[model samples]
Target: MIKVGIVGGTGYTGVELLRLLARHSGVKLQAVTSRKEAGMKVAEMYPSLRGWVDLAFSTPEDARLTECDVVFFATPNGIAMQQTGELLDAGVKVIDLAADYRIKDLSEWSKWYGMQHASPDLVEEAVYGLPEINRAAIRDARLIANPGCYPTAVQLGFLPLIEAGVIDAGSLIADCKSGVSGAGRKAEVGALFAEAGDNFKAYGVAGHRHLPEIRQGLTRIAGVDVGLTFVPHLTPLIRGIHATLYAKITQDVDLQALFEQRYLGEQFVDVLPAGSHPETRSVRGANVCRIAVHRPQGGDTVVILSVIDNLVKGAAGQAVQNMNILFDLPEGTGLDIVPLLP
Candidate 1:
């Protein structure tokens, strides 16, 4: 079995990884690290894994992780930068669910993340872990920078249009809403039940950190510079991301024809059947990303609606998908579980 270690295992994304990896037939979860929860049983914190993962949370200094074949960094951004190089140098594969190695430009990463990158040189070598976009490179990579929740959904939704040059890159806008869990499992004033429950509001306006990451992805498809007005909203729900992307069409186009032709035969990314709308409830706990397209008359813009569970496809689930590719395993192995619909 492939031995796996997860750092920062006490967070929402780390626990989500444990939940999914517990059922993977070919994996042995060797270690999970959490400084605050060190010496505590993981199952105690999350009863959902009572009988599955019996390991205790340890500190990052634990020797058990160095022995594993692969390590997942589910820690905060700065935390992973300090340890990823050591793990990779030890011949262990690394996957970071943070912002440490996602952006190619170190200065840009530093500006948004509010700290100088500790391992700026390694940034170029870390593969972007969006399987649909960079699967080939991921297979040979020792470190994978798992795409962020918002970027994953937005990039996937708009990639087709950018590729086809059907929309003006300067006129792009992504209005995304994510569940509270996307902010992490911390006791911040903004994440309190009182602050989030029964309320919906936009927080990050023009300069959200995710803007650069999204632009980086669009640049790849457009083969040139791209810009976007990215606004994010915090929903009272616990786990999902809905991204509504709008862009001015450069020419008259058929929405159905564009989406259908672009996503044909693409696994895990589905373009809904004609005239159908997708919901976050339909994709919760699953790796699927459902998208629908529309081009209403009297408007020169086209709208692309996309939805995904922020924790699943947006985080842990996509990390597992990257792991599958790194090992030459079938793209969907151990991840074929369907979405748990309401």
Candidate 2:
């Protein structure tokens, strides 16, 4: 079994990792760390993993994460960078579910994240963990930088068009909405039910942190720098992301077949039939992105709708998928979860 350790065990993504790793056939949970919650049973903090996860929370210093085969950092941005280098040097693979290593430009990362990178030397060596685009590198990488929830949905929706060279890349718009849980498990006035419930508002209209990551991924796909107008909104729901993307079509091709053929062999990305509108709930609780393509009256514009469970495909589930690739196991080993329905 592949021994695993997780840092930051009290957040939503942290517990989500525990919930999935608990049932992985090829995995064994070695350590789960939380400075504040040390010595607490994992099941005590999250009742959902009562029977599956039997480990308790320990401090990072006591976890001995270097002894594990791979360690996943579910902590905030700077936390992983502080410890990832030592772990990698100790022969333990590292996966970070944060913005620590996503952007290639160090100055850009510092400007957006507002701090000096703890491991700038390792940033160039860390592989971006979007399996669809960087699968081969992940298998040989000692460090994985998991993509953010919004970036995952946005990049998948725009990838087929950009790669086919059928859209005007300069005029791209991504209007996305995510659940309140995307803010993390912390207490905040914005995430409170009284404020977010029955309300919809865009917070990062000027520039959100995920913008650079999205642009970096898309630019890599298009083989040139791409311009994008990204706006992120917060929804009252608990666990999903809906990305409605728009681009002016510059060439004529079978849009449906393009998307279908692009993701033909991929198991997690589902391209619905032409004219279909994919709902966020259809992908809830599952490690899948359901997408649909449309052209209003065959106009000069193309609209793509994509959705995924933010906690699953966006965060922990994708991390597990990366782990599977890192170990050369089947991509869906412990991720065969069905979407939860009403």
Report the Cα lDDT for residue 340, model 2: 88
TM-score of 1: 0.97
Off by over 4 Å in 2: none
- For residue 108, model 1's alpha carbon misses the true position, in angstroms, by 1.0
Model 2 clashing residue pairs (backbone): none
Give each model a TM-score: 0.97, 0.99
Scored by lDDT, model 1 comes in at 0.90
Q: What's the true lDDT of residue 247 in model 1?
A: 93
Q: On residues 1-342, what C-alpha lDDT tens digit does candidate 2 reach at each position?
A: 999999998999999999889999999999999999999999998999989998999999999999999999999889999999889889999999999999999999999999999889999998999999999999999999999999999999999999999999999999999999999999899999999999999989999999999999999999988999999999989889999999999999899999999999898999999989998899988899999999999999999999999999999999999999999999999999988897
lDDT value, residue 103 of candidate 2: 93
lDDT of 1 by residue, 1-342 (tens): 889999999899999999999999879999999888899999999999999999999887874777999999999889889988888888999999999999998889888999999988789999999988898899999999999999999999999888888889987999999999999998998889999999999987958999999999999889989878999999999999999999998977777788888778777898997667789999999888999988767488888899999998999999999998898777777788888867
